[model samples]
Target: MEKYDNIDELTGLYNLNGILSHLQGHETRAAEGSIVIIYLNVMNFKSFNQRYGFVGGNEFLRGLAGEIKGLFPEELIARTAGDQFIILANSLDEKEITDRLTMLSEASARHDKGLRLHIKAGIYQQTGDETDPVIMVDRAKIACDDIIRVYDKSINFYDEALSKKNELRQYVIDNFESAFKNRYFKVYYQKEVRALTGKVCGYEALARWQDPVIGIISPLVFIEVLEDVHLIHKLDLCIIDMVCKDLRDDINSGYAVEPVSVNLSQLDFELCDIMAEIDKCRDRYDIPVELLHIEVTESALTTGADFLDQQIKKFRQAGYEIWMDDFGSGYSSLNNLKTFDIDVLKIDMDFLRTFDTNKKTPVILAMIVNMAKELGIHTLAEGVETKEQYEFLRRIGCEKLQGYLFGKPTPVDDFNRAVDCSFDVCEDFSLASYYDRIGEVNFLGNTPLRDKSFEIFNNLPLAIIELQDDIAQCIYANRAYLDYLSSLGFASLSEANSIYGTTNHPDIVEFTACLKRAQVSPDHRAYADIVTNGNTVNHKIRFLFDSGNRQAFAVVSRNTSIHEESDTAESLRVAMAHVFNQYFRVDFFDEDGTVDNIFLNADQKSVSDYTRDAKEAVRLYSEMYIYPEDKERFKKFYDITTVRDRIENTKSAYVVDYYRSATPGDNGRMQMYMILPFYYNGKWKFISLCRYADEIRDDDLK
Candidate 1:
């Protein structure tokens, strides 16, 4: 029974039971020699197992056991727990213990050349009155934790207070389920408000417990206890059920209740079919799925990408919106956004909390909000405790905000009152007051059509301006245009209105001349270099005279400041081929194998020849011009079907392929065709770069 129960089969080390038995036997027998039990722990053992395989981890443990046996003869050694070992060291002082630990560290370093193993030991001196071996071991483990944190220390003596703390923790774990069943565990809600309108949009459900023994216990304490006991999922499920019941009650009461977001732990999924449990709760209460939101922490997503993605898909499929909570609180914030299809990104409060201390915090917050907007995801700033933080978030266009300033987590009754009041107040504020404050719609005489038009274009990703050509004073500028000007250090449209032709600025003078010409011919298009905020940028301008309105409008299109050279080259080539149809024919091959050809009037016979029948030309190039040896490769590489499939599968904008093309020209020249394949308007098009045989490098294939 001792052998089966006490010995670890893999490493031949005595188990936790054996360690206890040895300590108890020594106490019963009154063994002499001042015995001290030292609990040893391998630091970051989980990381070790991840770096080396489980088999290797077991071997390493066995090897370390052997070395320990050699270091202390006739000592009782036991594997207490994961990466934890217990040793009964007799007749040894602190110095002797320290020396032994030093030797063990050196031996471990020598054993594994790639890895340096760190070991920490906690010592408990046994006295005659000490009866419970479990308590003694617990105290030693507590000391080991202290040593683990302080890297300079190799060994530490057990403290009485740590033992008491451990007893409290153990008590909480033992009574968790009973307390939860007795209604001590409860759900509290904190309202999430829209930053711009200050309207309560939803609530985040937070767990709280009023323990009988411990009185009101913070979730910060009980949550760790539950997690340690592998019972956090139980708490999460209970909270979800409570939220659903509350939502159903509110709906029955004829109150418009916002959706409540429930936090989930990574272990929740590992513990059970959480989705099934959530569905059961929803079905039982007959609650709409939209009323319950699922929030998973960003840190939880790091370990299991594929599994979490599947879980998220299931949640979304079941009509539940998923919010990535505590975003940027851990590593890979941007990566989490890319990997998960989250509906809302909740920025970590740490960003807002450090706003005053860190100069770059607000900039980072703004950038994150901008990035989320760019990805078509709404952003929620968490922990907005101050009016300054709220106003800053609002100015930066953060869609949602939640913090102490709005309200603390409260009971359902109080939360309902606050929600009702917020929505009522929001209703009193019209859309015009909230969104139409921009100059564009205000300058357009407030007509419904003009306001609707402004609304449509205001939120566009590009900067747009509706300019009156006569005065050239800025009449209307979209949100994008205002944001662009702000980024260039201009405060508003009025401050950045130097682009008007009325200004004596060189850029404006050139732009005015182009507008006048366009007004006369209706086809004159031009570009001007404008200096704003110490930086020069080229703006392409187009003018059109609306005959019915008797007003000429100038459209100023700003080019992106940061564009890749390859993109620029591609854009220029496409534009040149499009505008000068006489120089080179632009052929767009549809995914269905149909081709649209734009003819260029050029002296080259091949240009005219290909433009006459683009489809036949493409077929001949695939059949005849392709080198016989490279025919199969060329066919696969240049096939529009293959390009379309590649783009679809990879979600990539473009793909490039290079192959030998035997042009049907003088000398039957062997030229290299560098094909740039792109998908546009639901079709695939390849722009070929004609390289002469002399210019074809040997490394072109690579």
Candidate 2:
């Protein structure tokens, strides 16, 4: 009797109803022995399918299975799954384990024109501690994954976390593969609504991947891997060009869906001919110059100034718009604002996450909003998952928000419907669903209340939270909170009531303690004004609170969620500025005596890369000295004097213009920037700007 099923496709575990029945039938006469599961998967089988076609695929797999059955003398080998074989070794000598499995692999390779396949196998000695067969299989699979991820060929036992992680990773891999074939790629536009007047100012274009068979694969896996393989340029072109064509068709039809920003990775700039490609697409679709915006990260701006600046200049000359994406998401220390010629500066969702209605995240977002306002840089944030996060952004003078609170990234059809609907110019959305349904009637000892509480906690849309005794012991917040905390080096809530003082950061342990107290208080609030650790933020206990077991506080956030307007222009310059100013900047002296500033401006950040004021913008005047009237002029001149001079004088040490952006949005306004190189004090530096930005109009030009 076979111990496992034949058509199983998943990696980790398999159901054993068939095996149990087989065991039950023999219960009276068969002697019982331990169920030793020898799980083996031909490593890189997925890669194999991609490399070779089906004809070759079947020959190799079937050969391996035949070998497994023929060679193993003491165990029950079964075709458990695709490219994954399992054996129930009962009452077998443990010493012959390695030799038996190795022989099967060697025999498979010895076939005609065979591929050199490597295998990573997991061995689980199941003694049956109320263990389900499926769970046992999963344990073995996880052990295999653990070894493979770290590139180890050694055997692995069973670890619970490894199993769970393996399950999640396998799900991602399986779903992502299906996603690539289906229409998983899409761009969702959120209207950048002006909070004060409630006008449809523009839109922020967000990328989303959704597949019919696999559901949604978070950008975390696919986007990054694609970028590494230089496939992002294709994805960008597909999405951006699609937005451009859609906008033109919409405008021609009079539906009023404007041009918007499409996010571009730092790697996107490496193509060298990005501008040419964009221009070709725009012209092909008959799209106007006022309708495009190219945006990039701030760190990219500082380093990739020359190539990007050249591209931005071409876009500007051709009448395209420019922007700085992920503003306040990283180091803005050196005030690289002037270096890239940009129109909008996306205030990262991180700031919005920390915006406190009751000083929860604090109005610290105001600093960013006010800065953007003074500089004439438009501000928008993605990942605003709550009403509080949305409202705080608006109150602090921000004009846009995008998150689950507004709506998840939907398909083009769904997006079009939303754009034409009534939500054209408002930031208000709903969050009560994310919380407990307060109106539900509870009948049994507050069991309903408990259920509601858990529902709210488990479903708290954008963040991962940990609570103890009605107070939150820790929180793994969304992208927004992470960016803000990175500048302070206050990341990692693994430990309670602990604070680390980063370079150029003020210790906020005292503030952390107060915030902890508030979780249990009537108001449920606390406050802190800590500095970045060496100009970065880890943002620990930025607002840790214990919102009791009972539906505790009324949500301690300020980022008011907003509705998406399909037709608004989505610019990327703002998003670029957000990241550079908030999280990245590395000060390193070059041969010319200039700091060859290095920064890692990515679409996401790990918990560790926070706690310093972004690379080098000094706290004194860098944060608050620019007057509204002269902000643009001062920035321009500063970039020329510092970044420009360094690059020029050093005879190619650096250049003012280093990065490029090609963001697509819906405001009927596009953004791009140019960085000029210079040399200062025998050192190279960069200067940049997007003169076409709203922040740098004639009034601010000086």
Candidates in order have lDDT scores of 0.67, 0.50
Report the C-alpha lDDT of model 2 over 569-664, residue by residue, as the tens digit: 111211233223433222322233222223322211111123222223322222232334444444444343355455557666344221111212
Best-performing candidate as measured by lDDT? 1
Query: What range of 10 consecutive residues in model 2 has the weakest lDDT sum?
Result: 560-569
**How does candidate 2 fare on TM-score?**
0.36
lDDT of 1 by residue, 152-209 (tens): 6777886666566566677778888798779787888887887767877678999988
Candidate 1: which pairs clash? 581-600, 581-601, 582-600, 582-601
